[model samples]
Target: MNNKRFVILASIAALGLSGCAGYREKRGFILDEQLSQAVQVGTDNKTSVERTLGRPTFTGQFNDNEWYYVSRSTSTFAFRTPRVIDQTVLRIRFDPAGNVTAVERTGKDKIASIDPYGRTTPTLGRRKSFFEEFFGNIGTVGSGGLPGGGGQ
Candidate 1:
Protein backbone atom coordinates (compact mmCIF):
# COMPACT_ATOMS: atom_id res chain seq x y z
CA MET A 1 0.00 0.00 0.00
CA ASN A 2 2.84 2.42 0.78
CA ASN A 3 4.57 1.53 -2.51
CA LYS A 4 1.35 2.12 -4.41
CA ARG A 5 0.88 5.56 -2.75
CA PHE A 6 4.50 6.48 -3.47
CA VAL A 7 4.11 5.50 -7.10
CA ILE A 8 0.97 7.59 -7.43
CA LEU A 9 2.59 10.64 -5.84
CA ALA A 10 5.67 10.22 -8.00
CA SER A 11 3.51 10.03 -11.12
CA ILE A 12 1.68 13.20 -10.14
CA ALA A 13 4.96 15.00 -9.46
CA ALA A 14 6.33 13.85 -12.83
CA LEU A 15 3.28 15.16 -14.66
CA GLY A 16 3.52 18.49 -12.81
CA LEU A 17 7.19 18.83 -13.67
CA SER A 18 6.42 18.06 -17.31
CA GLY A 19 3.98 20.94 -17.37
CA CYS A 20 6.74 23.29 -16.15
CA ALA A 21 9.24 22.07 -18.75
CA GLY A 22 10.18 24.51 -21.50
CA TYR A 23 8.52 23.75 -24.82
CA ARG A 24 10.14 24.40 -28.20
CA GLU A 25 8.03 24.87 -31.27
CA LYS A 26 8.86 25.14 -34.93
CA ARG A 27 6.53 27.43 -36.81
CA GLY A 28 5.99 28.37 -40.46
CA PHE A 29 8.09 26.94 -43.28
CA ILE A 30 10.89 24.71 -41.94
CA LEU A 31 13.74 25.28 -44.36
CA ASP A 32 16.10 22.54 -45.45
CA GLU A 33 19.66 23.83 -45.77
CA GLN A 34 20.56 21.74 -48.76
CA LEU A 35 17.25 22.38 -50.53
CA SER A 36 17.49 26.12 -49.95
CA GLN A 37 21.08 26.17 -51.14
CA ALA A 38 20.14 24.31 -54.32
CA VAL A 39 18.11 27.31 -55.42
CA GLN A 40 20.56 29.45 -57.40
CA VAL A 41 19.98 32.92 -58.77
CA GLY A 42 19.79 33.17 -62.58
CA THR A 43 19.48 29.37 -62.73
CA ASP A 44 16.31 28.56 -60.77
CA ASN A 45 13.04 30.04 -62.01
CA LYS A 46 9.68 30.18 -60.30
CA THR A 47 8.57 26.72 -61.29
CA SER A 48 11.93 25.10 -60.49
CA VAL A 49 12.25 26.88 -57.17
CA GLU A 50 8.75 25.93 -56.23
CA ARG A 51 9.53 22.32 -57.05
CA THR A 52 12.74 22.42 -55.06
CA LEU A 53 11.64 24.32 -51.93
CA GLY A 54 7.86 23.88 -52.06
CA ARG A 55 5.56 26.91 -52.11
CA PRO A 56 6.65 30.14 -50.46
CA THR A 57 5.22 31.25 -47.09
CA PHE A 58 3.94 34.44 -48.66
CA THR A 59 4.42 36.58 -51.74
CA GLY A 60 5.40 40.22 -51.87
CA GLN A 61 2.59 42.67 -51.17
CA PHE A 62 2.98 44.61 -54.42
CA ASN A 63 4.28 42.01 -56.86
CA ASP A 64 4.21 38.22 -57.25
CA ASN A 65 7.80 38.18 -58.47
CA GLU A 66 9.23 38.40 -54.97
CA TRP A 67 8.69 35.41 -52.69
CA TYR A 68 9.39 35.06 -48.96
CA TYR A 69 10.03 31.77 -47.17
CA VAL A 70 9.96 32.48 -43.46
CA SER A 71 10.86 30.01 -40.71
CA ARG A 72 10.76 30.61 -36.97
CA SER A 73 11.43 28.50 -33.88
CA THR A 74 9.94 29.52 -30.55
CA SER A 75 10.31 28.38 -26.95
CA THR A 76 7.91 28.84 -24.07
CA PHE A 77 8.29 28.01 -20.37
CA ALA A 78 5.29 27.45 -18.15
CA PHE A 79 2.74 30.22 -18.85
CA ARG A 80 5.09 32.77 -20.38
CA THR A 81 4.84 34.21 -23.86
CA PRO A 82 6.58 32.23 -26.52
CA ARG A 83 9.96 33.76 -27.43
CA VAL A 84 11.52 33.37 -30.82
CA ILE A 85 14.75 31.34 -30.65
CA ASP A 86 15.54 31.04 -34.34
CA GLN A 87 14.22 32.94 -37.32
CA THR A 88 15.04 32.80 -40.98
CA VAL A 89 13.52 34.95 -43.69
CA LEU A 90 14.59 33.85 -47.13
CA ARG A 91 13.64 36.29 -49.86
CA ILE A 92 13.85 35.15 -53.47
CA ARG A 93 13.47 37.88 -56.02
CA PHE A 94 12.66 37.19 -59.65
CA ASP A 95 13.17 39.37 -62.71
CA PRO A 96 10.64 40.23 -65.40
CA ALA A 97 11.43 36.96 -67.17
CA GLY A 98 10.67 34.99 -63.94
CA ASN A 99 14.31 34.01 -63.40
CA VAL A 100 15.71 34.33 -59.89
CA THR A 101 17.42 37.71 -59.59
CA ALA A 102 18.49 37.74 -55.98
CA VAL A 103 18.47 35.40 -52.98
CA GLU A 104 18.50 37.11 -49.60
CA ARG A 105 18.43 35.64 -46.10
CA THR A 106 17.88 37.41 -42.75
CA GLY A 107 18.20 35.96 -39.25
CA LYS A 108 16.83 36.80 -35.79
CA ASP A 109 18.45 40.26 -35.87
CA LYS A 110 15.24 41.63 -37.38
CA ILE A 111 12.93 40.55 -34.57
CA ALA A 112 11.18 43.41 -32.76
CA SER A 113 9.48 43.55 -29.37
CA ILE A 114 6.78 46.12 -28.68
CA ASP A 115 5.48 46.79 -25.16
CA PRO A 116 2.36 48.91 -24.75
CA TYR A 117 2.25 51.77 -22.22
CA GLY A 118 0.75 50.98 -18.77
CA ARG A 119 -2.70 49.55 -18.11
CA THR A 120 -4.47 52.59 -19.61
CA THR A 121 -3.77 53.99 -23.06
CA PRO A 122 -2.80 57.68 -23.23
CA THR A 123 -5.27 59.61 -25.37
CA LEU A 124 -5.46 63.19 -26.64
CA GLY A 125 -8.50 64.16 -24.52
CA ARG A 126 -8.70 65.06 -20.85
CA ARG A 127 -9.58 62.27 -18.44
CA LYS A 128 -13.12 62.11 -17.01
CA SER A 129 -14.79 59.91 -14.39
CA PHE A 130 -17.64 57.49 -15.15
CA PHE A 131 -20.42 59.71 -13.71
CA GLU A 132 -19.02 62.80 -15.43
CA GLU A 133 -19.03 61.08 -18.84
CA PHE A 134 -22.54 59.66 -18.30
CA PHE A 135 -24.04 63.09 -17.42
CA GLY A 136 -21.58 65.38 -19.25
CA ASN A 137 -23.46 65.18 -22.61
CA ILE A 138 -26.84 66.12 -21.03
CA GLY A 139 -26.33 69.89 -21.28
CA THR A 140 -24.20 69.96 -24.44
CA VAL A 141 -26.74 68.36 -26.82
CA GLY A 142 -28.99 71.46 -27.04
CA SER A 143 -26.27 74.11 -26.65
CA GLY A 144 -25.96 74.57 -30.47
CA GLY A 145 -29.69 75.08 -31.41
CA LEU A 146 -30.98 78.15 -33.30
CA PRO A 147 -31.87 81.10 -31.06
CA GLY A 148 -35.14 82.12 -32.86
CA GLY A 149 -36.66 78.66 -33.42
CA GLY A 150 -39.20 78.59 -30.54
CA GLY A 151 -42.23 77.22 -32.55
CA GLN A 152 -43.99 80.28 -33.96
Candidate 2:
Protein backbone atom coordinates (compact mmCIF):
# COMPACT_ATOMS: atom_id res chain seq x y z
CA MET A 1 0.00 0.00 0.00
CA ASN A 2 2.78 2.43 0.88
CA ASN A 3 4.58 1.65 -2.40
CA LYS A 4 1.41 2.28 -4.43
CA ARG A 5 0.85 5.61 -2.67
CA PHE A 6 4.44 6.62 -3.33
CA VAL A 7 4.09 5.73 -7.01
CA ILE A 8 0.90 7.73 -7.32
CA LEU A 9 2.42 10.75 -5.57
CA ALA A 10 5.52 10.55 -7.72
CA SER A 11 3.46 10.40 -10.88
CA ILE A 12 1.46 13.41 -9.81
CA ALA A 13 4.63 15.35 -8.98
CA ALA A 14 6.12 14.50 -12.33
CA LEU A 15 3.02 15.65 -14.13
CA GLY A 16 2.98 18.92 -12.16
CA LEU A 17 6.60 19.63 -12.93
CA SER A 18 6.08 18.91 -16.61
CA GLY A 19 3.27 21.42 -16.65
CA CYS A 20 5.82 24.17 -15.87
CA ALA A 21 7.76 23.49 -19.04
CA GLY A 22 8.22 26.52 -21.26
CA TYR A 23 6.02 27.18 -24.29
CA ARG A 24 7.85 28.66 -27.25
CA GLU A 25 7.30 29.03 -30.97
CA LYS A 26 8.82 30.76 -33.95
CA ARG A 27 7.01 34.05 -34.29
CA GLY A 28 6.79 36.98 -36.74
CA PHE A 29 8.35 37.25 -40.17
CA ILE A 30 11.88 36.37 -41.24
CA LEU A 31 13.44 37.04 -44.56
CA ASP A 32 15.77 34.58 -46.17
CA GLU A 33 19.49 35.30 -45.77
CA GLN A 34 20.15 34.77 -49.46
CA LEU A 35 17.58 37.40 -50.38
CA SER A 36 20.17 40.16 -50.66
CA GLN A 37 22.28 38.24 -53.15
CA ALA A 38 19.44 36.46 -54.97
CA VAL A 39 17.54 39.67 -55.73
CA GLN A 40 19.12 42.29 -57.95
CA VAL A 41 18.19 45.01 -60.44
CA GLY A 42 17.01 43.76 -63.85
CA THR A 43 18.23 40.23 -63.18
CA ASP A 44 15.71 38.38 -60.99
CA ASN A 45 12.55 36.91 -62.43
CA LYS A 46 9.39 35.90 -60.57
CA THR A 47 10.27 32.22 -60.64
CA SER A 48 13.88 32.91 -59.64
CA VAL A 49 12.83 35.11 -56.72
CA GLU A 50 10.37 32.51 -55.51
CA ARG A 51 12.98 29.79 -55.76
CA THR A 52 15.74 31.76 -54.06
CA LEU A 53 13.84 33.53 -51.28
CA GLY A 54 10.91 31.13 -50.94
CA ARG A 55 7.40 32.58 -50.96
CA PRO A 56 7.12 36.21 -49.98
CA THR A 57 5.33 37.14 -46.75
CA PHE A 58 3.31 39.84 -48.47
CA THR A 59 2.66 40.83 -52.05
CA GLY A 60 1.27 44.14 -53.16
CA GLN A 61 -2.35 44.25 -54.28
CA PHE A 62 -2.14 47.48 -56.19
CA ASN A 63 0.67 46.09 -58.30
CA ASP A 64 0.95 42.37 -57.46
CA ASN A 65 4.36 43.43 -58.75
CA GLU A 66 5.97 44.06 -55.36
CA TRP A 67 6.87 41.40 -52.83
CA TYR A 68 7.60 41.91 -49.15
CA TYR A 69 9.67 39.45 -47.19
CA VAL A 70 9.37 39.98 -43.46
CA SER A 71 10.81 38.29 -40.36
CA ARG A 72 10.25 38.95 -36.69
CA SER A 73 11.16 37.34 -33.34
CA THR A 74 8.85 37.37 -30.36
CA SER A 75 9.92 36.11 -26.92
CA THR A 76 7.70 35.45 -23.94
CA PHE A 77 8.45 34.33 -20.39
CA ALA A 78 5.87 32.69 -18.19
CA PHE A 79 4.14 35.46 -16.22
CA ARG A 80 6.49 38.00 -17.71
CA THR A 81 6.32 40.66 -20.39
CA PRO A 82 6.51 39.42 -23.97
CA ARG A 83 8.39 41.45 -26.54
CA VAL A 84 9.49 41.51 -30.15
CA ILE A 85 13.27 41.14 -30.33
CA ASP A 86 13.97 41.70 -34.00
CA GLN A 87 12.16 42.47 -37.24
CA THR A 88 13.26 42.66 -40.87
CA VAL A 89 11.53 43.43 -44.12
CA LEU A 90 12.86 42.84 -47.60
CA ARG A 91 11.06 44.66 -50.35
CA ILE A 92 11.33 43.45 -53.93
CA ARG A 93 9.82 45.32 -56.82
CA PHE A 94 9.09 43.85 -60.18
CA ASP A 95 8.51 45.44 -63.52
CA PRO A 96 5.47 45.07 -65.78
CA ALA A 97 6.99 41.90 -67.21
CA GLY A 98 7.33 40.47 -63.67
CA ASN A 99 11.08 40.95 -63.76
CA VAL A 100 12.81 42.15 -60.60
CA THR A 101 13.61 45.85 -60.75
CA ALA A 102 14.98 46.53 -57.31
CA VAL A 103 15.46 44.92 -53.89
CA GLU A 104 15.51 46.81 -50.56
CA ARG A 105 16.19 45.54 -47.05
CA THR A 106 14.89 47.25 -43.93
CA GLY A 107 15.76 46.41 -40.33
CA LYS A 108 15.52 47.70 -36.75
CA ASP A 109 17.74 50.62 -37.63
CA LYS A 110 15.34 51.74 -40.34
CA ILE A 111 12.39 51.36 -38.00
CA ALA A 112 14.02 53.49 -35.30
CA SER A 113 14.92 56.17 -37.81
CA ILE A 114 11.41 56.10 -39.31
CA ASP A 115 9.53 56.16 -36.03
CA PRO A 116 11.58 57.95 -33.37
CA TYR A 117 8.60 58.85 -31.15
CA GLY A 118 7.08 55.36 -31.45
CA ARG A 119 3.78 57.17 -31.52
CA THR A 120 2.50 57.50 -35.04
CA THR A 121 -0.99 58.93 -34.74
CA PRO A 122 -3.55 56.65 -36.32
CA THR A 123 -5.89 58.17 -38.86
CA LEU A 124 -8.21 55.23 -39.00
CA GLY A 125 -11.11 53.50 -37.29
CA ARG A 126 -11.93 52.91 -33.62
CA ARG A 127 -10.06 50.46 -31.41
CA LYS A 128 -11.94 47.90 -29.32
CA SER A 129 -11.44 47.18 -25.60
CA PHE A 130 -9.15 44.35 -24.50
CA PHE A 131 -11.76 42.63 -22.35
CA GLU A 132 -14.35 42.75 -25.07
CA GLU A 133 -11.93 41.19 -27.54
CA PHE A 134 -10.49 38.55 -25.19
CA PHE A 135 -13.71 37.62 -23.40
CA GLY A 136 -16.06 38.38 -26.29
CA ASN A 137 -19.21 39.28 -24.34
CA ILE A 138 -18.53 39.71 -20.64
CA GLY A 139 -22.21 39.33 -19.72
CA THR A 140 -22.72 36.22 -21.82
CA VAL A 141 -22.69 33.08 -19.70
CA GLY A 142 -20.03 30.47 -20.45
CA SER A 143 -18.37 32.94 -22.84
CA GLY A 144 -16.25 35.21 -20.70
CA GLY A 145 -13.01 33.55 -19.60
CA LEU A 146 -9.81 34.04 -21.64
CA PRO A 147 -8.52 34.81 -25.08
CA GLY A 148 -8.43 31.15 -26.15
CA GLY A 149 -11.57 29.60 -24.73
CA GLY A 150 -11.59 26.19 -23.03
CA GLY A 151 -11.69 23.24 -25.38
CA GLN A 152 -9.90 20.03 -26.06
Candidate 3:
Protein backbone atom coordinates (compact mmCIF):
# COMPACT_ATOMS: atom_id res chain seq x y z
CA MET A 1 0.00 0.00 0.00
CA ASN A 2 2.80 2.44 0.90
CA ASN A 3 4.65 1.58 -2.34
CA LYS A 4 1.55 2.35 -4.37
CA ARG A 5 1.16 5.68 -2.60
CA PHE A 6 4.78 6.64 -3.26
CA VAL A 7 4.48 5.77 -6.94
CA ILE A 8 1.39 7.91 -7.34
CA LEU A 9 3.07 10.84 -5.59
CA ALA A 10 6.14 10.59 -7.79
CA SER A 11 4.11 10.48 -10.98
CA ILE A 12 2.08 13.49 -9.92
CA ALA A 13 5.23 15.42 -9.09
CA ALA A 14 6.75 14.63 -12.46
CA LEU A 15 3.66 15.77 -14.33
CA GLY A 16 3.46 19.00 -12.31
CA LEU A 17 7.07 19.87 -13.00
CA SER A 18 6.68 19.21 -16.73
CA GLY A 19 3.79 21.66 -16.89
CA CYS A 20 6.15 24.50 -15.97
CA ALA A 21 8.18 24.11 -19.12
CA GLY A 22 7.64 26.79 -21.75
CA TYR A 23 8.37 26.85 -25.44
CA ARG A 24 11.30 29.07 -26.38
CA GLU A 25 11.96 30.42 -29.87
CA LYS A 26 14.84 32.32 -31.38
CA ARG A 27 14.50 34.23 -34.64
CA GLY A 28 16.48 36.45 -37.00
CA PHE A 29 20.20 37.01 -36.90
CA ILE A 30 22.03 34.65 -34.57
CA LEU A 31 24.59 37.00 -33.07
CA ASP A 32 27.97 35.60 -32.16
CA GLU A 33 29.93 37.66 -29.67
CA GLN A 34 33.28 36.91 -31.29
CA LEU A 35 32.16 37.52 -34.85
CA SER A 36 30.29 40.68 -33.99
CA GLN A 37 33.31 41.99 -32.11
CA ALA A 38 35.55 41.12 -35.01
CA VAL A 39 33.89 43.73 -37.22
CA GLN A 40 35.92 46.90 -36.96
CA VAL A 41 34.93 50.39 -37.92
CA GLY A 42 36.82 51.84 -40.90
CA THR A 43 38.33 48.39 -41.44
CA ASP A 44 35.27 46.34 -42.29
CA ASN A 45 33.28 47.15 -45.40
CA LYS A 46 30.03 45.75 -46.65
CA THR A 47 31.68 42.64 -47.97
CA SER A 48 33.73 42.00 -44.83
CA VAL A 49 30.77 42.64 -42.60
CA GLU A 50 28.70 40.27 -44.63
CA ARG A 51 31.43 37.64 -44.30
CA THR A 52 31.66 38.19 -40.57
CA LEU A 53 28.03 38.57 -39.62
CA GLY A 54 26.20 37.21 -42.65
CA ARG A 55 23.48 39.27 -44.32
CA PRO A 56 21.83 41.87 -42.18
CA THR A 57 18.27 41.44 -41.00
CA PHE A 58 17.54 44.51 -43.02
CA THR A 59 19.20 47.52 -44.49
CA GLY A 60 18.26 51.14 -44.10
CA GLN A 61 14.87 51.93 -45.59
CA PHE A 62 16.08 54.82 -47.71
CA ASN A 63 19.63 53.72 -48.36
CA ASP A 64 22.12 50.92 -47.93
CA ASN A 65 24.42 52.91 -45.70
CA GLU A 66 22.81 51.49 -42.58
CA TRP A 67 22.39 47.78 -41.78
CA TYR A 68 20.53 46.24 -38.88
CA TYR A 69 21.00 42.79 -37.39
CA VAL A 70 18.22 41.86 -35.03
CA SER A 71 18.02 38.89 -32.65
CA ARG A 72 15.02 38.02 -30.55
CA SER A 73 13.93 35.19 -28.27
CA THR A 74 10.40 34.57 -27.22
CA SER A 75 8.83 32.17 -24.72
CA THR A 76 5.30 30.90 -24.53
CA PHE A 77 3.65 28.97 -21.74
CA ALA A 78 0.75 26.66 -22.47
CA PHE A 79 -1.38 28.44 -25.08
CA ARG A 80 -0.47 32.01 -24.12
CA THR A 81 0.99 34.57 -26.48
CA PRO A 82 4.73 34.53 -26.87
CA ARG A 83 6.58 37.11 -24.84
CA VAL A 84 9.93 38.51 -25.77
CA ILE A 85 12.61 37.26 -23.42
CA ASP A 86 15.61 38.71 -25.16
CA GLN A 87 16.29 41.05 -28.05
CA THR A 88 19.31 42.65 -29.63
CA VAL A 89 19.42 45.20 -32.41
CA LEU A 90 22.85 45.82 -33.86
CA ARG A 91 22.99 48.74 -36.22
CA ILE A 92 26.05 49.26 -38.38
CA ARG A 93 26.37 52.42 -40.36
CA PHE A 94 28.62 52.71 -43.37
CA ASP A 95 29.93 55.67 -45.22
CA PRO A 96 29.39 56.30 -48.92
CA ALA A 97 32.54 54.27 -49.53
CA GLY A 98 30.82 51.23 -47.95
CA ASN A 99 33.19 51.12 -44.99
CA VAL A 100 31.63 50.73 -41.61
CA THR A 101 31.58 54.04 -39.81
CA ALA A 102 29.83 53.04 -36.59
CA VAL A 103 28.43 50.05 -34.78
CA GLU A 104 25.59 50.49 -32.33
CA ARG A 105 24.34 47.65 -30.11
CA THR A 106 21.00 47.84 -28.34
CA GLY A 107 19.27 45.32 -26.10
CA LYS A 108 15.76 44.63 -24.95
CA ASP A 109 15.55 48.20 -23.66
CA LYS A 110 14.96 49.25 -27.25
CA ILE A 111 11.99 46.95 -27.67
CA ALA A 112 8.63 48.66 -27.83
CA SER A 113 5.43 47.18 -26.45
CA ILE A 114 2.47 48.63 -28.27
CA ASP A 115 -1.11 47.97 -27.32
CA PRO A 116 -3.64 48.57 -30.04
CA TYR A 117 -6.20 51.27 -29.38
CA GLY A 118 -9.01 48.82 -28.75
CA ARG A 119 -10.58 46.70 -31.49
CA THR A 120 -11.81 49.56 -33.65
CA THR A 121 -9.87 52.61 -34.79
CA PRO A 122 -11.52 55.98 -34.34
CA THR A 123 -12.30 57.41 -37.76
CA LEU A 124 -12.90 60.98 -38.85
CA GLY A 125 -16.29 60.63 -40.50
CA ARG A 126 -19.20 59.07 -38.57
CA ARG A 127 -20.31 55.90 -36.88
CA LYS A 128 -22.94 53.68 -38.43
CA SER A 129 -24.82 50.63 -37.27
CA PHE A 130 -24.51 47.23 -38.93
CA PHE A 131 -27.75 47.67 -40.83
CA GLU A 132 -26.81 51.19 -41.96
CA GLU A 133 -23.43 50.04 -43.24
CA PHE A 134 -25.04 47.08 -45.00
CA PHE A 135 -27.82 49.00 -46.76
CA GLY A 136 -26.28 52.50 -46.88
CA ASN A 137 -24.67 52.01 -50.33
CA ILE A 138 -27.67 50.25 -51.83
CA GLY A 139 -29.07 53.12 -53.94
CA THR A 140 -25.94 55.29 -53.99
CA VAL A 141 -24.03 53.38 -56.67
CA GLY A 142 -24.55 53.42 -60.53
CA SER A 143 -26.29 56.80 -60.20
CA GLY A 144 -23.24 59.00 -60.76
CA GLY A 145 -22.50 58.84 -57.02
CA LEU A 146 -18.92 58.45 -58.19
CA PRO A 147 -17.16 61.17 -60.11
CA GLY A 148 -16.52 59.13 -63.33
CA GLY A 149 -19.40 56.69 -63.10
CA GLY A 150 -21.48 58.55 -65.73
CA GLY A 151 -24.48 56.56 -64.54
CA GLN A 152 -27.89 57.37 -66.09
All candidates' lDDT scores? 0.92, 0.75, 0.92
lDDT of 3 by residue, 20-99 (tens): 78899999999999999999998899999998899999999998899999999999997788999999999999999999
Against the true structure, candidate 2 reaches a TM-score of: 0.53
Better of 2 and 3 by TM-score: 3
Candidate 1 ranges with C-alpha deviation above 4 Å: 1-12, 126-128, 131-152
Candidate 1, residues 51-106, lDDT tens digits: the string is: 99999999999999999999999999999999999999999999989999999999
Q: Model 1 TM-score?
A: 0.72
Off by over 4 Å in 2: 1-24, 28-30, 79-81, 109-152
Alpha-carbon error at 22 in model 1, in Å?
2.2
Task: Give the CA lDDT, 0 to 100, for residue 92 in model 3.
Answer: 98
Please give each candidate's TM-score. Answer: 0.72, 0.53, 0.81
CA lDDT, candidate 1, residue 111 = 85
Off by over 4 Å in 3: 1-21, 145-152
Provide the global lDDT of candidate 3 against the true structure.
0.92
